[model samples]
Target: MTEEEPRLSAREMIERLDSSLSPGRRVRAVAALLAGLAGAVFVAALWWTEPGPLPGRTHLAFALFTVFCLAWSGYGGWLLTRRVPLFATDRVIAAWIGLAASLTTTTVLAVVAAQRDTGLGGTLLVGGLFAGMALVLAVRARTRRAALLRRVRELTGQEDR
Candidate 1:
């Protein structure tokens, strides 16, 4: 009599899905927490230290930064937890490009505002926060992809070849 291969139980399937989703979800959660904390800190520091009144332009810039951070962190967290394929190569690349542009433009604007009055530390703090988030997302996506590919290869008995 021929032996049949054992089938995966439902629990095993669920576990696999959880494993695939966990890394990305963790990354997103961390990113969100960092962003929120950083945003609060930036606002507090700006309120305390900035000499002159906050310029309208600076306020606008801060608003933009706040929106971007909240959107990215919230959406990214949702996508990761749901195991959505939102981080395809093209999408990831596009996101990184956007991050770069936002960071650069915000920094420039902040610097200009600071030159007008020496007390705006908000820009530096927020920039660092976003930079850290970008780094975390990039690393998590890359690692997850690599691990998935490796698992596929192992399952197919193609790794050594």
Candidate 2:
């Protein structure tokens, strides 16, 4: 469309003024590619490090890392397909941060279990602390996400969905 043509959407206007038509798509595609490649490399590292040998603390650490990479890869794939707008990326980022925090806590606990004896009291304490923090973060993220959606609706001149 030419400059004289009226763009009906924020996306279209942005694309017209800017150089890219699908900026969000581009960002998501890059993330997906990088995450997928990282996942594959981590899987390979898992095989190389363990090699079906005796499982040790170090192997457990590597396994945790591999799982993290795979999870991120899947997340990236979901993001890529979701087609989130630039303004909405903040909400997505907030959600991802919360998810990463919880995943880290879980992975750390798993690694700890792999390293030493599984103690109920100690595990429960640490788990409870992190779980509470995760809950707080999740609630905050939801608030931010709602605010972001409201802002998007305002910009788009659309009714609340």
Candidate 3:
């Protein structure tokens, strides 16, 4: 009834995105899937290899990484459901990249800690990596989003009409 009301439901949102995807978007999705699969494989390998006893700090780092991934994934899913224009294909690709980076960092730190028997160093490494990755991703996303908004404004003129 309102001019600003959303016309799509959650399922419809996903369907619309899938239907309107460009070739580039499709490629990005495929790349994200591959990256996620690789991450999963790496995690599984870590478990299977049983590198050895881990330090308490490494365990803490793993837990933090798990929590971060869960939170960010949920946020991404919410954005997808809402069908926010700002959450474009590029943003999704970035999210996947961030996820992969976090996973890989956590896994590597855990393995290194186990192998070297140095929990504290592994924990610090994982924490520092997570913080750095998050900051970088946030800045990149914000920059891209700002550029997108500027482009939209240029195309549509002012919204004061």
**Per-residue lDDT of 33 in model 3:** 51
Give the higher-TM-score candidate: 1 or 2. 2
Q: lDDT by residue for model 2 over 30-130, one digit each (tens)? A: 68558766776967666686546655755665665666666666656555565334444534564565467565656677657756768746766777777
Ranking of all predicted structures according to TM-score, beginning with the best and ending with the worst: 2, 3, 1
Summarize candidate 3's per-residue lDDT along 1-161 as a digit string, tens digits: 65897666544544454434456754555554554445445544564566788778666555555544444444444433443444344574565557565666666676667777889575867667785776677677777777766655555454632
Error of 1 at 27 (Å): 3.6
Superior by TM-score: candidate 2 or candidate 3: 2
lDDT of 1 by residue, 1-161 (tens): 99998898544543555335456556655676576557656755665577878877667666665555555555545554555333244245435645674576657767786877855687777777777777677766677666765665566556454
Local distance difference test scores for all models: 0.60, 0.63, 0.57
Model 2, residue 141: distance off in Å is 2.3
Query: What's the TM for model 1?
Result: 0.42
Worst 10 residues of 1 by lDDT: 85-94
Per-structure clash totals for the candidates: 0, 0, 0
Q: What are the RMSDs of all candidates, in order?
A: 8.0, 6.4, 9.3
**Candidate 3 deviant stretches above 4 angstroms:** 1-19, 60-89, 92-141, 153-161
